[model samples]
Target: MRKLVCVAAMLSLGVTQVTFSADLAGAKDHPLVSRFRGADAVGYGQADFGNARLPSGANGKHTDAAGRLTDIVYRAPPGKRAAEVFENYRQALAGAGFAISWQCGPGTRDDGCGGFRFAGDLADPVIATLKGDSSEMIKLLDATNNNVSYLIATLVKNGQTSTVALMVSQDDERPTGVLLRVIDAAPMAQGQVTVDAAAMAKGLAAEGKITLYGLHFATDSATLTPDSKQTLDEMAKALKAAPALKVYIVGHTDNTGALAHNEKLSQDRAAAVVKALTTTYGIAANRLAAKGLASYSPVAANTSEPGKAKNRRVEMVAQ
Candidate 1:
Protein backbone atom coordinates (compact mmCIF):
# COMPACT_ATOMS: atom_id res chain seq x y z
CA MET A 1 0.00 0.00 0.00
CA ARG A 2 3.03 2.29 0.13
CA LYS A 3 3.35 4.51 -2.93
CA LEU A 4 6.02 7.03 -3.72
CA VAL A 5 4.56 10.46 -3.30
CA CYS A 6 4.26 12.11 -6.69
CA VAL A 7 6.68 14.84 -7.56
CA ALA A 8 4.98 18.17 -8.27
CA ALA A 9 6.89 18.34 -11.55
CA MET A 10 8.29 15.70 -13.87
CA LEU A 11 12.06 15.52 -13.70
CA SER A 12 13.92 16.91 -16.68
CA LEU A 13 15.76 14.02 -18.30
CA GLY A 14 18.44 16.23 -19.80
CA VAL A 15 19.01 15.91 -23.55
CA THR A 16 16.99 12.84 -24.30
CA GLN A 17 19.14 10.42 -26.29
CA VAL A 18 19.00 6.67 -26.00
CA THR A 19 21.83 4.49 -24.66
CA PHE A 20 19.86 1.34 -23.84
CA SER A 21 16.60 0.89 -25.70
CA ALA A 22 14.74 -1.76 -23.76
CA ASP A 23 13.76 -2.36 -20.17
CA LEU A 24 14.54 -5.77 -18.76
CA ALA A 25 11.76 -8.30 -19.34
CA GLY A 26 9.08 -8.33 -16.64
CA ALA A 27 10.63 -5.25 -15.09
CA LYS A 28 8.55 -2.26 -14.16
CA ASP A 29 8.70 0.78 -11.93
CA HIS A 30 8.26 0.27 -8.20
CA PRO A 31 5.00 1.81 -7.03
CA LEU A 32 6.89 4.17 -4.74
CA VAL A 33 9.09 5.91 -7.31
CA SER A 34 8.38 6.63 -10.96
CA ARG A 35 11.20 6.19 -13.43
CA PHE A 36 13.11 9.11 -14.85
CA ARG A 37 11.90 9.85 -18.34
CA GLY A 38 13.96 8.17 -21.10
CA ALA A 39 15.80 6.01 -18.61
CA ASP A 40 16.31 2.33 -19.35
CA ALA A 41 15.64 -0.14 -16.55
CA VAL A 42 18.57 -2.44 -17.14
CA GLY A 43 18.22 -4.34 -13.89
CA TYR A 44 15.35 -5.11 -11.49
CA GLY A 45 14.53 -7.48 -8.64
CA GLN A 46 11.97 -7.75 -5.84
CA ALA A 47 11.33 -10.02 -2.91
CA ASP A 48 8.24 -10.52 -0.77
CA PHE A 49 10.43 -10.42 2.32
CA GLY A 50 14.10 -9.49 2.31
CA ASN A 51 16.82 -7.27 3.71
CA ALA A 52 18.81 -4.44 2.15
CA ARG A 53 21.82 -2.84 3.89
CA LEU A 54 22.18 0.65 2.48
CA PRO A 55 24.17 3.55 3.89
CA SER A 56 22.58 6.12 6.16
CA GLY A 57 25.30 8.71 6.38
CA ALA A 58 29.05 9.12 5.96
CA ASN A 59 31.66 6.64 7.23
CA GLY A 60 30.28 3.16 6.57
CA LYS A 61 27.02 3.54 8.54
CA HIS A 62 23.92 1.85 7.10
CA THR A 63 20.14 1.91 7.07
CA ASP A 64 19.84 -1.84 7.26
CA ALA A 65 16.22 -3.02 7.01
CA ALA A 66 14.18 -6.13 6.32
CA GLY A 67 10.87 -5.93 4.54
CA ARG A 68 9.44 -5.86 1.03
CA LEU A 69 12.62 -5.06 -0.94
CA THR A 70 12.95 -3.89 -4.55
CA ASP A 71 16.08 -3.16 -6.54
CA ILE A 72 15.92 -0.96 -9.63
CA VAL A 73 18.89 -0.15 -11.85
CA TYR A 74 18.66 2.43 -14.57
CA ARG A 75 20.86 3.87 -17.25
CA ALA A 76 20.00 7.52 -17.81
CA PRO A 77 19.38 8.89 -21.26
CA PRO A 78 22.51 9.74 -23.15
CA GLY A 79 23.79 13.28 -22.48
CA LYS A 80 22.27 13.23 -18.98
CA ARG A 81 24.78 13.82 -16.22
CA ALA A 82 24.85 11.73 -13.06
CA ALA A 83 24.56 14.86 -10.92
CA GLU A 84 21.44 15.93 -12.76
CA VAL A 85 19.86 12.50 -12.24
CA PHE A 86 20.73 12.46 -8.54
CA GLU A 87 19.20 15.90 -8.00
CA ASN A 88 15.95 14.75 -9.56
CA TYR A 89 15.70 11.83 -7.16
CA ARG A 90 16.65 14.05 -4.24
CA GLN A 91 13.83 16.46 -5.02
CA ALA A 92 11.38 13.63 -5.50
CA LEU A 93 12.15 12.23 -2.06
CA ALA A 94 12.02 15.64 -0.48
CA GLY A 95 8.66 16.33 -2.07
CA ALA A 96 7.45 13.09 -0.51
CA GLY A 97 8.36 14.34 2.99
CA PHE A 98 11.52 12.28 3.17
CA ALA A 99 14.64 13.35 5.06
CA ILE A 100 18.02 12.82 3.50
CA SER A 101 19.90 10.87 6.12
CA TRP A 102 23.21 10.64 4.31
CA GLN A 103 24.67 11.95 1.08
CA CYS A 104 28.12 11.96 -0.43
CA GLY A 105 30.14 12.55 -3.60
CA PRO A 106 32.33 15.39 -4.84
CA GLY A 107 29.39 16.61 -6.90
CA THR A 108 27.24 16.41 -3.76
CA ARG A 109 29.40 18.70 -1.62
CA ASP A 110 30.91 15.53 -0.08
CA ASP A 111 34.17 14.81 -1.83
CA GLY A 112 34.99 12.33 0.91
CA CYS A 113 31.69 10.81 1.98
CA GLY A 114 33.70 7.70 2.34
CA GLY A 115 33.52 7.30 -1.43
CA PHE A 116 36.43 4.88 -1.76
CA ARG A 117 35.49 3.01 1.41
CA PHE A 118 31.70 3.21 1.02
CA ALA A 119 31.89 1.94 -2.54
CA GLY A 120 33.87 -1.06 -1.35
CA ASP A 121 31.29 -1.67 1.39
CA LEU A 122 28.15 -1.19 -0.68
CA ALA A 123 29.04 -2.47 -4.14
CA ASP A 124 28.93 -6.18 -3.51
CA PRO A 125 25.89 -6.06 -1.22
CA VAL A 126 24.01 -4.04 -3.79
CA ILE A 127 25.09 -6.15 -6.74
CA ALA A 128 24.07 -9.36 -5.01
CA THR A 129 20.50 -8.05 -4.94
CA LEU A 130 20.42 -7.31 -8.66
CA LYS A 131 18.90 -9.99 -10.90
CA GLY A 132 18.89 -8.55 -14.38
CA ASP A 133 20.69 -9.26 -17.61
CA SER A 134 22.48 -5.94 -17.33
CA SER A 135 23.66 -6.32 -13.77
CA GLU A 136 27.01 -4.90 -14.83
CA MET A 137 25.23 -1.54 -14.71
CA ILE A 138 26.01 -1.50 -10.98
CA LYS A 139 29.73 -1.14 -11.68
CA LEU A 140 29.23 2.55 -12.18
CA LEU A 141 29.17 2.86 -8.38
CA ASP A 142 32.76 1.69 -8.37
CA ALA A 143 33.98 5.13 -9.36
CA THR A 144 34.81 8.11 -7.20
CA ASN A 145 34.30 11.17 -9.34
CA ASN A 146 32.45 14.40 -9.86
CA ASN A 147 29.71 12.31 -11.43
CA VAL A 148 29.19 10.12 -8.35
CA SER A 149 26.42 10.93 -5.85
CA TYR A 150 24.70 8.71 -3.25
CA LEU A 151 21.78 9.38 -0.92
CA ILE A 152 19.84 7.39 1.64
CA ALA A 153 16.52 9.02 2.41
CA THR A 154 13.76 7.96 4.76
CA LEU A 155 10.05 8.77 5.25
CA VAL A 156 7.80 8.19 8.22
CA LYS A 157 4.02 8.20 8.01
CA ASN A 158 1.46 7.13 10.58
CA GLY A 159 4.03 5.50 12.84
CA GLN A 160 5.60 3.41 10.08
CA THR A 161 8.82 4.24 8.26
CA SER A 162 10.23 3.16 4.91
CA THR A 163 13.64 3.67 3.34
CA VAL A 164 14.87 4.55 -0.16
CA ALA A 165 18.48 4.60 -1.33
CA LEU A 166 19.53 6.45 -4.46
CA MET A 167 22.93 6.39 -6.11
CA VAL A 168 23.99 8.00 -9.39
CA SER A 169 27.40 7.05 -10.65
CA GLN A 170 29.04 6.88 -14.04
CA ASP A 171 32.18 4.97 -14.82
CA ASP A 172 34.69 6.93 -16.86
CA GLU A 173 33.57 5.13 -20.00
CA ARG A 174 30.01 4.04 -19.25
CA PRO A 175 26.77 5.99 -19.35
CA THR A 176 25.35 7.50 -16.17
CA GLY A 177 23.60 4.83 -14.10
CA VAL A 178 21.24 4.94 -11.10
CA LEU A 179 20.57 2.33 -8.51
CA LEU A 180 17.31 2.74 -6.55
CA ARG A 181 16.63 0.35 -3.74
CA VAL A 182 13.45 0.70 -1.71
CA ILE A 183 12.51 -1.18 1.44
CA ASP A 184 8.86 -0.82 2.38
CA ALA A 185 8.20 -1.85 5.96
CA ALA A 186 5.45 -4.46 5.85
CA PRO A 187 4.48 -7.75 7.40
CA MET A 188 4.62 -10.57 4.90
CA ALA A 189 1.13 -11.37 3.63
CA GLN A 190 0.25 -14.61 5.38
CA GLY A 191 -1.68 -17.59 3.94
CA GLN A 192 -0.86 -16.40 0.44
CA VAL A 193 2.87 -17.05 0.13
CA THR A 194 3.73 -20.24 1.93
CA VAL A 195 3.82 -23.89 0.91
CA ASP A 196 0.42 -25.49 1.26
CA ALA A 197 -0.39 -28.50 3.38
CA ALA A 198 -0.41 -30.80 0.38
CA ALA A 199 3.05 -29.75 -0.68
CA MET A 200 4.39 -30.13 2.84
CA ALA A 201 2.91 -33.61 2.96
CA LYS A 202 4.37 -34.42 -0.45
CA GLY A 203 7.82 -33.31 0.59
CA LEU A 204 7.69 -35.28 3.80
CA ALA A 205 6.44 -38.38 2.01
CA ALA A 206 9.25 -38.15 -0.52
CA GLU A 207 12.14 -37.18 1.72
CA GLY A 208 11.00 -38.52 5.11
CA LYS A 209 11.34 -34.93 6.33
CA ILE A 210 10.73 -31.40 5.12
CA THR A 211 12.96 -28.41 5.72
CA LEU A 212 10.91 -25.36 6.66
CA TYR A 213 12.56 -22.11 5.79
CA GLY A 214 9.25 -20.30 5.84
CA LEU A 215 9.19 -20.62 9.59
CA HIS A 216 11.21 -17.62 10.67
CA PHE A 217 12.63 -16.61 14.03
CA ALA A 218 14.67 -13.72 15.24
CA THR A 219 18.43 -14.31 15.40
CA ASP A 220 19.10 -16.86 18.16
CA SER A 221 15.52 -16.78 19.40
CA ALA A 222 12.83 -19.40 19.69
CA THR A 223 9.82 -17.13 19.22
CA LEU A 224 8.31 -17.23 15.72
CA THR A 225 7.67 -13.98 13.95
CA PRO A 226 4.27 -12.85 12.68
CA ASP A 227 5.13 -13.68 9.07
CA SER A 228 5.62 -17.28 10.09
CA LYS A 229 1.91 -17.81 10.77
CA GLN A 230 1.06 -19.13 7.32
CA THR A 231 3.77 -21.75 7.37
CA LEU A 232 2.64 -22.82 10.80
CA ASP A 233 -0.91 -23.03 9.51
CA GLU A 234 0.17 -25.36 6.74
CA MET A 235 2.10 -27.43 9.24
CA ALA A 236 -0.98 -27.76 11.41
CA LYS A 237 -3.06 -28.86 8.44
CA ALA A 238 -0.47 -31.49 7.52
CA LEU A 239 -0.71 -32.88 11.01
CA LYS A 240 -4.48 -33.02 10.81
CA ALA A 241 -4.35 -34.92 7.53
CA ALA A 242 -2.59 -37.86 9.20
CA PRO A 243 -3.89 -38.30 12.70
CA ALA A 244 -1.78 -41.27 13.73
CA LEU A 245 1.54 -40.17 12.27
CA LYS A 246 4.36 -39.51 14.69
CA VAL A 247 6.51 -36.50 13.85
CA TYR A 248 9.62 -34.83 15.17
CA ILE A 249 10.02 -31.07 15.02
CA VAL A 250 13.77 -30.63 14.74
CA GLY A 251 15.62 -27.30 14.77
CA HIS A 252 19.11 -26.56 13.50
CA THR A 253 21.42 -23.57 13.87
CA ASP A 254 24.53 -22.30 12.22
CA ASN A 255 27.90 -22.32 13.99
CA THR A 256 27.93 -18.68 14.98
CA GLY A 257 27.73 -18.48 18.78
CA ALA A 258 28.88 -20.49 21.74
CA LEU A 259 28.21 -24.23 21.59
CA ALA A 260 26.11 -24.43 24.76
CA HIS A 261 24.06 -21.39 23.82
CA ASN A 262 23.36 -22.69 20.33
CA GLU A 263 22.37 -26.10 21.61
CA LYS A 264 19.87 -24.64 24.06
CA LEU A 265 18.58 -22.14 21.53
CA SER A 266 17.93 -24.80 18.94
CA GLN A 267 16.18 -27.01 21.48
CA ASP A 268 13.95 -24.11 22.54
CA ARG A 269 12.97 -23.46 18.93
CA ALA A 270 11.98 -27.06 18.24
CA ALA A 271 10.06 -27.06 21.48
CA ALA A 272 8.23 -23.91 20.47
CA VAL A 273 7.04 -25.57 17.28
CA VAL A 274 5.84 -28.60 19.18
CA LYS A 275 4.12 -26.31 21.66
CA ALA A 276 2.34 -24.47 18.88
CA LEU A 277 1.11 -27.62 17.18
CA THR A 278 -0.06 -29.20 20.39
CA THR A 279 -1.70 -26.18 22.03
CA THR A 280 -2.79 -23.87 19.23
CA TYR A 281 -3.83 -26.48 16.67
CA GLY A 282 -5.07 -29.13 19.13
CA ILE A 283 -2.63 -31.80 18.02
CA ALA A 284 -1.87 -34.56 20.50
CA ALA A 285 1.33 -33.81 22.39
CA ASN A 286 2.14 -37.52 22.62
CA ARG A 287 2.21 -37.84 18.83
CA LEU A 288 5.05 -35.28 18.47
CA ALA A 289 8.66 -35.07 19.60
CA ALA A 290 11.18 -32.21 19.49
CA LYS A 291 14.95 -32.12 19.13
CA GLY A 292 17.76 -29.76 18.30
CA LEU A 293 20.64 -30.64 15.99
CA ALA A 294 22.66 -27.50 16.85
CA SER A 295 24.84 -27.23 13.75
CA TYR A 296 25.60 -30.89 13.67
CA SER A 297 23.38 -31.63 10.67
CA PRO A 298 23.87 -28.63 8.44
CA VAL A 299 22.44 -28.90 4.95
CA ALA A 300 24.93 -26.32 3.70
CA ALA A 301 28.36 -25.02 4.68
CA ASN A 302 28.54 -22.35 7.39
CA THR A 303 31.03 -20.14 5.58
CA SER A 304 28.65 -17.50 4.19
CA GLU A 305 25.61 -15.59 5.37
CA PRO A 306 23.49 -17.34 2.76
CA GLY A 307 24.81 -20.69 3.92
CA LYS A 308 24.21 -19.85 7.56
CA ALA A 309 20.65 -18.89 6.68
CA LYS A 310 20.16 -22.23 5.03
CA ASN A 311 21.46 -24.11 8.04
CA ARG A 312 19.07 -22.37 10.45
CA ARG A 313 15.80 -24.08 9.74
CA VAL A 314 13.12 -26.28 11.22
CA GLU A 315 12.46 -29.71 9.78
CA MET A 316 9.47 -31.96 10.23
CA VAL A 317 10.74 -35.53 10.26
CA ALA A 318 8.62 -38.65 10.18
CA GLN A 319 9.23 -41.32 12.78
Candidate 2:
Protein backbone atom coordinates (compact mmCIF):
# COMPACT_ATOMS: atom_id res chain seq x y z
CA MET A 1 0.00 0.00 0.00
CA ARG A 2 1.20 3.52 -0.78
CA LYS A 3 1.16 5.38 2.50
CA LEU A 4 1.62 9.10 2.99
CA VAL A 5 3.78 10.68 5.67
CA CYS A 6 6.79 9.06 7.35
CA VAL A 7 5.55 7.16 10.34
CA ALA A 8 7.51 3.96 9.84
CA ALA A 9 9.60 4.96 12.85
CA MET A 10 6.46 4.57 14.92
CA LEU A 11 6.97 0.84 14.83
CA SER A 12 9.88 1.12 17.23
CA LEU A 13 7.56 2.58 19.83
CA GLY A 14 5.62 -0.71 20.12
CA VAL A 15 3.14 0.27 17.40
CA THR A 16 4.51 -2.63 15.33
CA GLN A 17 1.19 -4.20 14.60
CA VAL A 18 -0.17 -3.50 11.11
CA THR A 19 -3.48 -3.86 9.41
CA PHE A 20 -4.70 -2.82 6.00
CA SER A 21 -7.97 -1.64 4.52
CA ALA A 22 -9.12 0.59 1.74
CA ASP A 23 -9.02 4.26 2.62
CA LEU A 24 -11.89 6.43 1.35
CA ALA A 25 -11.92 6.79 -2.44
CA GLY A 26 -9.46 9.42 -3.61
CA ALA A 27 -8.21 9.64 -0.01
CA LYS A 28 -4.80 8.81 1.30
CA ASP A 29 -2.31 9.73 4.01
CA HIS A 30 -0.50 13.04 4.03
CA PRO A 31 2.70 11.56 2.45
CA LEU A 32 4.76 13.29 5.16
CA VAL A 33 2.79 12.38 8.29
CA SER A 34 1.32 8.94 8.71
CA ARG A 35 -1.65 7.54 10.52
CA PHE A 36 -1.93 5.22 13.56
CA ARG A 37 -1.33 1.59 12.59
CA GLY A 38 -4.39 -0.20 11.30
CA ALA A 39 -6.29 3.08 11.31
CA ASP A 40 -8.73 3.38 8.45
CA ALA A 41 -9.01 6.77 6.87
CA VAL A 42 -12.65 7.79 6.89
CA GLY A 43 -12.13 11.28 5.57
CA TYR A 44 -9.34 12.99 3.67
CA GLY A 45 -8.87 16.34 2.03
CA GLN A 46 -5.91 18.27 0.73
CA ALA A 47 -5.07 21.72 -0.55
CA ASP A 48 -1.93 21.81 -2.64
CA PHE A 49 -1.46 25.36 -1.47
CA GLY A 50 -3.77 27.36 0.70
CA ASN A 51 -4.28 28.93 4.11
CA ALA A 52 -4.97 27.12 7.39
CA ARG A 53 -6.15 28.65 10.64
CA LEU A 54 -5.18 26.28 13.47
CA PRO A 55 -6.18 27.00 17.03
CA SER A 56 -3.21 27.46 19.29
CA GLY A 57 -2.66 28.09 23.00
CA ALA A 58 -5.56 28.69 25.33
CA ASN A 59 -7.71 31.84 25.14
CA GLY A 60 -8.57 31.75 21.44
CA LYS A 61 -5.12 32.37 19.96
CA HIS A 62 -4.74 30.94 16.44
CA THR A 63 -1.91 30.12 14.09
CA ASP A 64 -2.89 30.97 10.55
CA ALA A 65 -0.49 29.64 7.95
CA ALA A 66 -0.47 29.33 4.18
CA GLY A 67 0.91 26.24 2.49
CA ARG A 68 0.00 22.69 1.50
CA LEU A 69 -2.72 21.60 3.95
CA THR A 70 -3.69 17.94 4.34
CA ASP A 71 -6.40 16.89 6.74
CA ILE A 72 -7.09 13.22 7.49
CA VAL A 73 -9.69 11.63 9.70
CA TYR A 74 -8.52 8.21 10.85
CA ARG A 75 -10.26 5.64 13.00
CA ALA A 76 -8.03 3.14 14.74
CA PRO A 77 -8.97 -0.52 15.04
CA PRO A 78 -11.03 -1.70 17.96
CA GLY A 79 -9.57 -1.89 21.50
CA LYS A 80 -7.57 1.30 21.06
CA ARG A 81 -8.00 4.34 23.27
CA ALA A 82 -7.85 7.92 22.04
CA ALA A 83 -5.09 8.72 24.50
CA GLU A 84 -2.97 5.90 23.11
CA VAL A 85 -3.46 7.19 19.59
CA PHE A 86 -2.58 10.72 20.66
CA GLU A 87 0.52 9.48 22.48
CA ASN A 88 1.69 7.49 19.47
CA TYR A 89 1.58 10.59 17.30
CA ARG A 90 3.48 12.64 19.91
CA GLN A 91 6.33 10.16 20.05
CA ALA A 92 6.41 9.64 16.31
CA LEU A 93 6.50 13.36 15.68
CA ALA A 94 9.29 13.77 18.23
CA GLY A 95 11.24 10.96 16.58
CA ALA A 96 10.77 12.77 13.29
CA GLY A 97 12.48 15.86 14.78
CA PHE A 98 9.36 17.82 15.55
CA ALA A 99 8.93 20.03 18.61
CA ILE A 100 5.72 20.25 20.51
CA SER A 101 4.47 23.81 20.39
CA TRP A 102 1.35 23.35 22.46
CA GLN A 103 -0.58 20.37 23.80
CA CYS A 104 -3.54 19.69 26.08
CA GLY A 105 -5.46 16.62 27.19
CA PRO A 106 -8.48 16.19 29.39
CA GLY A 107 -8.32 17.21 33.08
CA THR A 108 -5.21 19.28 32.39
CA ARG A 109 -6.76 22.74 32.48
CA ASP A 110 -9.02 25.12 34.41
CA ASP A 111 -11.56 26.87 32.13
CA GLY A 112 -11.15 23.83 29.92
CA CYS A 113 -9.99 24.12 26.36
CA GLY A 114 -13.49 25.38 25.79
CA GLY A 115 -12.00 28.77 26.58
CA PHE A 116 -9.70 28.20 23.62
CA ARG A 117 -12.73 28.22 21.34
CA PHE A 118 -11.37 25.75 18.83
CA ALA A 119 -14.87 24.92 17.64
CA GLY A 120 -15.82 28.49 16.93
CA ASP A 121 -12.40 29.54 15.75
CA LEU A 122 -11.70 26.59 13.47
CA ALA A 123 -15.11 26.05 11.96
CA ASP A 124 -13.64 26.11 8.48
CA PRO A 125 -11.28 23.21 9.05
CA VAL A 126 -14.05 21.20 10.66
CA ILE A 127 -16.37 21.82 7.78
CA ALA A 128 -13.71 20.94 5.25
CA THR A 129 -12.74 17.72 6.99
CA LEU A 130 -16.32 16.60 7.50
CA LYS A 131 -17.48 16.97 3.91
CA GLY A 132 -14.72 14.94 2.28
CA ASP A 133 -16.04 11.39 1.68
CA SER A 134 -19.04 11.69 3.98
CA SER A 135 -19.25 12.68 7.68
CA GLU A 136 -20.94 9.45 8.73
CA MET A 137 -17.71 7.56 9.39
CA ILE A 138 -16.40 10.33 11.63
CA LYS A 139 -19.64 10.89 13.50
CA LEU A 140 -20.13 14.26 15.18
CA LEU A 141 -16.50 15.30 14.55
CA ASP A 142 -16.79 17.20 17.81
CA ALA A 143 -13.26 16.71 19.00
CA THR A 144 -12.44 20.36 18.47
CA ASN A 145 -15.20 21.49 20.82
CA ASN A 146 -15.00 18.66 23.31
CA ASN A 147 -12.38 18.27 26.02
CA VAL A 148 -10.29 15.88 23.97
CA SER A 149 -6.58 15.26 23.56
CA TYR A 150 -4.81 17.50 21.09
CA LEU A 151 -1.32 18.71 20.23
CA ILE A 152 0.49 20.90 17.73
CA ALA A 153 4.01 20.14 16.58
CA THR A 154 6.44 21.79 14.19
CA LEU A 155 9.45 20.59 12.22
CA VAL A 156 12.01 22.84 10.59
CA LYS A 157 13.94 21.28 7.78
CA ASN A 158 16.07 22.91 5.09
CA GLY A 159 14.94 26.36 6.20
CA GLN A 160 11.28 25.44 5.74
CA THR A 161 8.93 24.65 8.58
CA SER A 162 6.14 22.08 8.57
CA THR A 163 3.45 22.07 11.23
CA VAL A 164 1.08 19.28 12.19
CA ALA A 165 -1.85 19.30 14.57
CA LEU A 166 -3.53 16.20 15.98
CA MET A 167 -6.84 15.97 17.79
CA VAL A 168 -8.14 12.68 19.18
CA SER A 169 -11.68 11.85 20.21
CA GLN A 170 -12.85 9.36 22.85
CA ASP A 171 -16.55 9.15 22.17
CA ASP A 172 -18.33 6.15 23.61
CA GLU A 173 -20.42 5.67 20.48
CA ARG A 174 -17.56 5.72 18.02
CA PRO A 175 -14.11 4.34 17.44
CA THR A 176 -11.08 6.44 18.32
CA GLY A 177 -10.82 9.06 15.57
CA VAL A 178 -7.77 11.17 14.93
CA LEU A 179 -7.92 14.46 13.14
CA LEU A 180 -4.46 14.92 11.61
CA ARG A 181 -3.64 18.04 9.72
CA VAL A 182 -0.26 19.06 8.34
CA ILE A 183 0.94 22.24 6.65
CA ASP A 184 4.37 23.07 5.29
CA ALA A 185 5.55 26.57 4.53
CA ALA A 186 6.10 27.34 0.86
CA PRO A 187 6.48 30.41 -1.35
CA MET A 188 3.43 31.29 -3.35
CA ALA A 189 4.04 31.67 -7.04
CA GLN A 190 4.56 35.38 -7.65
CA GLY A 191 2.10 36.56 -10.24
CA GLN A 192 -0.49 39.25 -10.60
CA VAL A 193 -1.73 38.82 -7.03
CA THR A 194 -1.99 42.59 -7.11
CA VAL A 195 -4.66 44.67 -8.75
CA ASP A 196 -4.25 47.46 -11.29
CA ALA A 197 -5.63 50.98 -11.03
CA ALA A 198 -8.91 50.13 -12.80
CA ALA A 199 -9.59 47.30 -10.37
CA MET A 200 -8.49 49.49 -7.51
CA ALA A 201 -10.97 52.22 -8.45
CA LYS A 202 -13.76 49.71 -8.76
CA GLY A 203 -12.87 48.15 -5.40
CA LEU A 204 -12.81 51.54 -3.68
CA ALA A 205 -16.12 52.48 -5.22
CA ALA A 206 -17.73 49.23 -4.08
CA GLU A 207 -16.20 48.72 -0.64
CA GLY A 208 -14.95 52.14 0.46
CA LYS A 209 -11.50 50.56 0.77
CA ILE A 210 -9.03 48.76 -1.48
CA THR A 211 -6.05 46.64 -0.43
CA LEU A 212 -2.97 47.03 -2.62
CA TYR A 213 -0.01 44.66 -3.01
CA GLY A 214 1.86 46.58 -5.68
CA LEU A 215 4.08 48.64 -3.37
CA HIS A 216 7.50 47.01 -3.05
CA PHE A 217 9.90 47.19 -0.11
CA ALA A 218 12.92 45.33 1.17
CA THR A 219 12.94 43.31 4.31
CA ASP A 220 12.24 45.51 7.33
CA SER A 221 12.65 48.64 5.21
CA ALA A 222 10.16 51.16 3.83
CA THR A 223 11.90 52.35 0.68
CA LEU A 224 9.96 51.65 -2.51
CA THR A 225 11.66 49.69 -5.25
CA PRO A 226 12.24 51.21 -8.70
CA ASP A 227 9.56 48.93 -10.17
CA SER A 228 7.04 50.46 -7.77
CA LYS A 229 6.88 53.57 -9.94
CA GLN A 230 4.42 51.92 -12.31
CA THR A 231 2.04 51.13 -9.49
CA LEU A 232 2.47 54.65 -8.15
CA ASP A 233 1.77 56.10 -11.58
CA GLU A 234 -1.43 54.09 -11.74
CA MET A 235 -2.39 55.29 -8.32
CA ALA A 236 -1.70 58.86 -9.36
CA LYS A 237 -3.96 58.40 -12.34
CA ALA A 238 -6.70 56.98 -10.13
CA LEU A 239 -6.44 59.90 -7.75
CA LYS A 240 -6.53 62.34 -10.66
CA ALA A 241 -9.60 60.61 -12.09
CA ALA A 242 -11.41 61.17 -8.84
CA PRO A 243 -10.38 64.71 -8.03
CA ALA A 244 -12.62 65.06 -4.97
CA LEU A 245 -11.75 61.70 -3.43
CA LYS A 246 -10.00 61.73 -0.10
CA VAL A 247 -8.51 58.50 1.18
CA TYR A 248 -6.52 57.10 4.08
CA ILE A 249 -3.19 55.61 3.01
CA VAL A 250 -2.94 52.89 5.62
CA GLY A 251 0.14 50.66 5.95
CA HIS A 252 0.03 47.10 7.20
CA THR A 253 2.64 44.43 7.92
CA ASP A 254 2.83 40.73 8.71
CA ASN A 255 2.94 39.57 12.30
CA THR A 256 6.65 39.14 12.77
CA GLY A 257 9.23 40.35 15.31
CA ALA A 258 8.25 42.86 17.96
CA LEU A 259 4.83 44.45 17.56
CA ALA A 260 6.17 47.90 18.34
CA HIS A 261 8.87 47.71 15.70
CA ASN A 262 6.38 46.65 13.05
CA GLU A 263 4.16 49.54 14.09
CA LYS A 264 6.93 52.07 13.53
CA LEU A 265 7.96 50.44 10.25
CA SER A 266 4.41 50.44 8.97
CA GLN A 267 4.06 54.12 9.83
CA ASP A 268 7.25 54.88 7.97
CA ARG A 269 6.06 52.94 4.92
CA ALA A 270 2.79 54.86 4.90
CA ALA A 271 4.62 58.13 5.20
CA ALA A 272 6.87 57.17 2.32
CA VAL A 273 3.80 56.55 0.14
CA VAL A 274 2.35 59.87 1.16
CA LYS A 275 5.61 61.64 0.37
CA ALA A 276 5.78 60.11 -3.09
CA LEU A 277 2.18 61.00 -3.80
CA THR A 278 2.45 64.63 -2.75
CA THR A 279 5.94 65.44 -3.97
CA THR A 280 6.14 63.28 -7.10
CA TYR A 281 2.58 62.31 -8.07
CA GLY A 282 1.00 65.77 -7.47
CA ILE A 283 -1.60 64.55 -4.94
CA ALA A 284 -2.40 67.16 -2.35
CA ALA A 285 -1.18 66.35 1.16
CA ASN A 286 -4.39 67.36 2.87
CA ARG A 287 -6.43 64.89 0.90
CA LEU A 288 -4.54 61.90 2.19
CA ALA A 289 -4.18 60.68 5.77
CA ALA A 290 -1.39 58.16 6.51
CA LYS A 291 -1.99 55.59 9.21
CA GLY A 292 -0.11 52.47 10.28
CA LEU A 293 -1.91 49.36 11.43
CA ALA A 294 1.30 47.31 11.57
CA SER A 295 0.37 43.64 11.89
CA TYR A 296 -2.85 44.48 13.66
CA SER A 297 -4.78 44.40 10.37
CA PRO A 298 -3.66 41.49 8.23
CA VAL A 299 -5.27 40.32 5.03
CA ALA A 300 -3.59 36.95 5.48
CA ALA A 301 -1.83 34.87 8.11
CA ASN A 302 1.78 35.61 9.02
CA THR A 303 2.86 32.03 9.64
CA SER A 304 4.22 31.50 6.12
CA GLU A 305 5.95 33.73 3.60
CA PRO A 306 3.01 33.67 1.22
CA GLY A 307 0.56 34.49 3.98
CA LYS A 308 2.91 37.20 5.22
CA ALA A 309 3.22 38.55 1.69
CA LYS A 310 -0.53 39.08 1.52
CA ASN A 311 -0.59 40.66 4.96
CA ARG A 312 2.16 43.19 4.15
CA ARG A 313 0.21 45.56 1.97
CA VAL A 314 -1.13 49.10 1.82
CA GLU A 315 -4.79 50.03 1.68
CA MET A 316 -6.72 53.07 0.48
CA VAL A 317 -9.81 53.63 2.56
CA ALA A 318 -12.27 56.32 1.60
CA GLN A 319 -12.00 59.20 4.00
Specify the highest-TM-score model's number: 2
* Global lDDT scores for all candidate models: 0.75, 0.73
Candidate 1 per-residue lDDT, tens place, 241-267, comes to 988888999999999999789899999
TM-score, one value per model = 0.56, 0.61
lDDT of 1 at 17: 26
**Which residue runs of candidate 1 sit more than 4 Å off their true CA positions?**
1-21, 107-112, 115-118, 144-146, 158-160, 189-319
What is candidate 2's lDDT per residue for 1-319, written digit by digit as tens?
Answer: 2222356453232343333456776666664577777788777777778777776787766787768777777877788777777777887788778889888776222234636543334433465554455454435245533546778888877677888888777566567777788897775644255577788799899999988777877778989877677778888888999999999999998888899999999999998999999999899999898999999977766656887878888888999
Best by lDDT: 1
TM-score of 2: 0.61
lDDT of 2 at 223: 92
What is the number of backbone collisions in each predicted candidate, taken in the order shown?
Answer: 1, 4
lDDT for 263 in candidate 2 is 94
